[model samples]
Target: MKMLINVPETVVSDALRGLAAAHPDLTVDVEHQVIVRRDAPVAGKVGLVSGGGSGHEPLHGGFVGPGMLDAACPGAVFTSPVPDQMARAAAAVDSGKGVLFIVKNYTGDVLNFNMAAEMAEDEGIQVASVLVNDDVAVTDSLYTAGRRGTGATLFVEKIAGAAADEGAPLERVEALARRVNESSRSFGVALSACTTPSKGSPTFDLPPGELELGIGIHGEPGRERRAMMTSREIADFAVNAVLEDLEPTGPVLVLVNGMGATPQLELYGFNAEVQRVLGERGVTAARTLVGNYVTSLDMAGCSVTLCQADDELMRLWDAPVQTPGLRWGR
Candidate 1:
């Protein structure tokens, strides 16, 4: 209900304007609603593109830069971007090395991005895609559209973009991305719900003292709801479930993402608890990241993602990456 905005319909478009102005290195395609790196088609480097709804800030758009994504398509708030936007990004960033599309496992995202791939192919562009379905909370693949690609999408984009930046072949990059997707698992808990700009109210209700488990980023109800508990207890439940599923043999990469509105100070404490639980379970976190990587609009919740890693994967994971959202190796 209490939000800083002039109107709902202009939320996404207006935000895009602000993003472009704030990050001069990223060029906003106002017409198509695509954000491309200021220096796209970096000679022979393969282009990387990821697109999704807008509310997930610093996602597809935040990640448009040198080492990560060449371009990102932003749809209306919580709505998938049309294929036309993606097609423009594909054309603008094609550098003869092909393009890799990192798509999340949402029905609308998959459909729109895949269609854009087709549109790009019509003009003889080589486009490959990897669908990230790493959320393990939703087990019934037959019933649901696989698992919701939550925080794992961040790892996928960074690692895959690094691979492409290294001049790895498109097929190899695609394969590596798939490996990350398969080896990763995620689960979330929500303490409060989010309100969309258009609606001007919470999407769903999570009573003052209740929390939902296995929650998705779209404000979708989780598999289970229960009484609130301490951070340690919540960390135990989330870490235990992910560790149980992966049983990672060696060092694993962990991401504790805040579902918007949870302050970073809290995220650090949350990560500490996550680390403690993993240590108790005899799991080593080779690389630990804690922040708001993927988030619901304004939901007070968090999700933890784990990717079982090998030497090669870890090396690739550590490789240089640059983007508006995630920039390193500067």
Candidate 2:
């Protein structure tokens, strides 16, 4: 148990303090544990709020900015934030228009976020929710809480945020969100495990010459653990799974995401394989983003996200976005 923290309980609070200080444009709801844009309640504009565990940086929190999330609440490391926090977030972000909650498919996340939505509705706030379930991995397995929401969350948030920021109606925003979900698929592999600061040790041990297929963020065991293979082979398996699931005939927005510890060199190497796979299927990668967008803290591996793209999807994707985690041409 070798960790660098003085107190395990203070991890989230301390991190939130630093986050708020670092970004004054966003306000921290200390009581609710949610980070919201300072000028919230933009009249007649749909509000977008999402939340999850704390370990996945730049996810719910780092994404709170222009053309993205309106609010992101933090739970404990890999744990869901409480319903009260979400309720407060919904209430704060809601303008006269409406509110949309983007939740992953995880049981805890769904339950808590839904509870908050229900609570907000009691206050006469119209709330809509879109659950992201993009992982190609089996959900009922023992490793994950359910079909873990992985790479596609980024695309969903970005596109939905763009629509919301554009003052699109709540129905349009929700429709776009579901469109993104229907067209996107994700797959991942793990070479190493993550260490929870509280636990002060790795969550699981992977033998020297093996890998986990369809791994989840909370160190849930993937569908299958097998001997390690070449990056090309691994990419083939992952990309193929997504392709099979999606059966996409057109272009895609490809996201080659490293779990945590996998290096950029490895990511590029894996991308090469993904490129080959895409070429074989007559699928052009219209927009390719490679990095660690969502991670399982310090775990080594990568996930491939295929977002089926059209002209409309591309326009929204290319829209300017500024957030702590992702900023480009804004």
Candidate 3:
């Protein structure tokens, strides 16, 4: 229960305030809990909006900027943002082209975003949605009907956002998003569980010297819990699962994402192993990102995401991006 905060209820709001202070380029709608780029509604470009719970930092919120999300609605810790929050973001960012919602495949996220999209449409805003379901962990989990969405969310947002930033039409951007999801797969392993600030305790319990395979970001039950193994072995397990699911046979985009507490040194070591495994399968990593992009609060572990990239996808991925969380080549 030991956490640095004034009160449990105010954790998300307080953090949003801090986020606004820390990054002036982002405008925080404190009342609505939506974060957007200061220069929103970019004239003719299709807007990109994505959101979810608040615990995972640098996700939807930190990703709001040029070449990424136009707006991001953050909810309470581990809770889906309300439809009003999303509708406000969509309205604020939508230009003449349209707005695309990047929704993860969780039940609450799907439902809330759907309601928001309908609301936006009622106001004469053209809207499209791309659902991310690249987690090969489970077909039906506690929070989703089909496979859960995880690391591939970053890939979808970045690649599709790049296309949108290039003035691509809403339909073309939506199609690119779907292509990213279709070509991507992910698998995660957890050494420890995360503690939501509101709960003030770990979401799940894992005994020392053990790990949970195929874990979800919300601390949901994974495929299995087993004794701890070496980093190479763990990488083998995760990368193999994604490879088997996708059967990718060409250049791929690789992301070795820390679940929060895992150090960068260890993540690089894990990334090496993942690349080694991919090399054995005759797949080359055209672009690789290692570090904490998507996280599960303070949980310790990592997930591997593999996206089979063609020339167009690779080009889009390498496009300049200027966001708080991910920025390069700008």
Models sorted by TM-score, best on top: 3, 1, 2
Between candidates 2 and 3, the TM-score winner: 3
lDDT string, candidate 2, 1-330, tens digits = 565566989888888888889999999866569899998977778999999998888787989988889899889999999999888889889996889999988888889998999999999989999989899888654424556687889999999998888889999999999999889999989998889888877788899999989888788878789999999899889999988899887889999998888999989988999999999888899999988889888889999999999998899999988888887774
Question: How do the residues 245-266 of candidate 1 rate in per-residue lDDT, one tens digit apiece?
Answer: 8888888999999999999999
- For candidate 2, what is the lDDT? 0.88
Worst 10 residues of 3 by lDDT: 195-204
- Screening candidate 1 with a backbone cut-off below 3 angstroms (N, C-alpha, C), the clashing residue pairs are 62-325
| Whole-model alpha-carbon lDDT for candidate 3 | 0.93
User: What would the TM-score be for candidate 3 when compared with the true structure?
Assistant: 0.98
TM-score per candidate, chains pooled: 0.97, 0.96, 0.98
lDDT against the true structure, each candidate: 0.86, 0.88, 0.93
Worst-scoring 10-residue span by lDDT in model 2: 139-148
Model 2 residue 183 distance off true place after TM-score fit, in angstroms: 0.9
Q: How many residue pairs clash in each candidate?
A: 1, 0, 0
* Model 3 misplaced stretches (Cα beyond 4 Å): none
TM-score of 2: 0.96
